[model samples]
Target: MLTKKSLIGLTALGALALNAVPAMAQVTAGSQEVHAYVGETFGDDLTDRRISGRTPELDDDVTYGLRYGYNFTDAWGLELSLGQTNSAVTGLPGRDIDLDLTTFDVDAVYHFNPSGRFVPYVVAGLGYASADLDRPIIGAVNGGSVRIGDDNGFTANAGVGAKYFVTDKVSLRLDARYRYLDKVVDRFDDSLNTFETTFGVGFHF
Candidate 1:
């Protein structure tokens, strides 16, 4: 009832039909998203080996950040962010160790309610950060007042956030995140850590 050519053609047609089923079932959340935001970093601290042979503490103050992301599907996406903060070395009263920090990160994100007006997401990422010490307390150990030596390291963070869509193209976003980084000075045993909160507007296309 069938020729060889007909059998081959039918088999090819069946394969194409099967492939089309999956293609038709696939759904995408959005192609891309960009956001600009300003926020504050809190609960940030550092420990460093001091000239007195004891570890001294530093505290981070206000912070600001911006982020951009791409979505592969309704539930999966990737993001990149940049942030900056100011800090001061504590426990050393007279000596000023003004520090400014900058960080860059890339993350994988998941949206639990991608199709809803309000979407909740979780994000985790790997990053790099640098601390600029404005005034060097140890001149011989560090070269200049803006000591960048031993102030750069690997970083990591994780957080939760939500987006409330006001329209098809715009949304309001709020997030809180925490990060951990390697110590600036080798002798310090504790790693640096920070917690931050942010609110911003996002656009999707």
Candidate 2:
């Protein structure tokens, strides 16, 4: 007596129920933890438009950040990070542009070995960024100021990091991550892409 649509819906519901049974059985109390890290970051700036008759140089710089995480289970967790990049522009006469980039990111991490002391994981996140540009000579020449505002973007990151457990409540961490940030700057009839590599330490509690 059931229509085809009804039959398909019932079958899908059955599959979902079967898949969720194990997840419900594996739930545990969440662990709240905080981490701080400092690392060197190399950045590449890809711009479609030329500035002052030259392409914007990719900046290799240092970056540092802090993060906090909540582990809902042995295999799954959520994390947030705040990081910054320092860079400059070249080839402009007394025209130096200092770029300060800030990012707020939230990601989900999945550990490969849930029960091992050395846990390696992969992560992906969404990020929001702000770029502050300081141009001393450009402002002096034009009697005006130029600044890049906060922009919304998506970031995809994949890295291998090992967690060495020092104690039940603490761990030592080392990570190498490569982040691809969406194009945020599209001024002067051009678009720019930003990328960063970071290494740092973290403590888990």
Candidate 3:
């Protein structure tokens, strides 16, 4: 029997599959490519100990990463990527904290316009992440500061993106993704979901 979370994940994937069918018709057999890129990651509002029905938020910041992929067919490709972000913690009163996040993922992508100048794709992946929260300023008496221990867990992400090929070997890529994290950290019992958008240039070989 499929659980609630499993059902939701499948539904989202099905929608993307439908959109990629038309694009599959245009793909050439045995087409392969490799790419490298850099981008930013943004985390969503996180709830630690809820205070008066409110949750604290983490500030969004720049992130950089690289990706490598191979296309077995025009519509189907596999991608592995790594990225990291250092973001300051906000919304906590009288606290100075910084959170560092790292991600490694393997995704399957479906390109909708593989032969055209503009190619649109949807990607879904399983990822591993490590998160660390540290106090930036040292103080003997930090007032009620919420301290989160370093932890790691599994994650899943889904996103839509586009690539515009400038030449046979170069392209501009733009992506927007939503990442759902399990065990956001060791302390938090619930999951964390974040949104990230990035722009980068890719080189294919």
Candidate 4:
């Protein structure tokens, strides 16, 4: 026969064991999820120009946008992002140009360790970019109006990022990426390239 004290102790132990089973199940279920993030991108422009005797310069600018991703497996996922960047040009007198660049991209990401609190990933993607260039240029030979057309092109991007999970539902992220853009034609042939670094927060569901 069980004594009163022994009965109470056994009952408490059984209750504790029963509670622990759900906690373990929760941990296993938390590893696989879909997440969405919104963040701002801050970095220098890595604009490369292949024009002879001309160098490309990019102004400091910031872009803000949203990203949505879906995890297919424990370690692989795909993400799509949309954002815009504004660039200004200097060094050429009366040739200061402000460009608006909009981007849409989809990438495949491989997470290093999805079960860990801190996860790192590498990503590569193909995308399209559209740029509208606005600037004033003074004619060298004869003073005349030379309006430059809007420049649009296809772009490609690749990058790596690390995320720190604050909880099962939230994380902090940092990323660095390189983008190559198509050519732009004006009084001078110009093209834009970019190296972007972004830091932001994410939510998992």
TM per prediction: 0.73, 0.69, 0.74, 0.68
TM-score of 3: 0.74
Model 4, residue 178: distance off in Å is: 1.2
Q: Which lDDT values do the candidates have, in the order given?
A: 0.66, 0.56, 0.67, 0.59
Error of 3 at 172 (Å): 0.6
Writing each residue's lDDT as its tens digit, candidate 1 over 1-205 gives: 2223433543454344334322111114557887765566664335544434433465646665678888888999999988776666655535757777788999999988687777899999998988777765442224223222336888899999997666666666788889888765443435877787876666677
State in Å the error of residue 192, model 3: 1.5
Candidate 4 to truth, TM: 0.68
Q: Which of the numbered candidates is closest to the native, going by highest TM-score?
A: 3
* Model 3 deviation from native, Cα RMSD in Å: 11.4
Cα-based lDDT at residue 151, candidate 1: 66
Better by TM-score, candidate 4 or 2 = 2
The reply for model 3, stretches above 4 Å from the true place, is 1-38, 51-54, 136-147
Error of 4 at 52 (Å): 12
Error of 4 at 7 (Å): 59
lDDT of 2: 0.56
Residue 189 CA error for candidate 2 (Å)? 7.0
What digit string (tens of lDDT, one per residue) describes model 2 on residues 149-204? Answer: 22345556656676544444454456777676664453432234444444333434
Per-candidate RMSD vs. true structure?
Answer: 17.4, 16.7, 11.4, 15.0
| Order of candidate numbers by TM-score, starting with the best | 3, 1, 2, 4
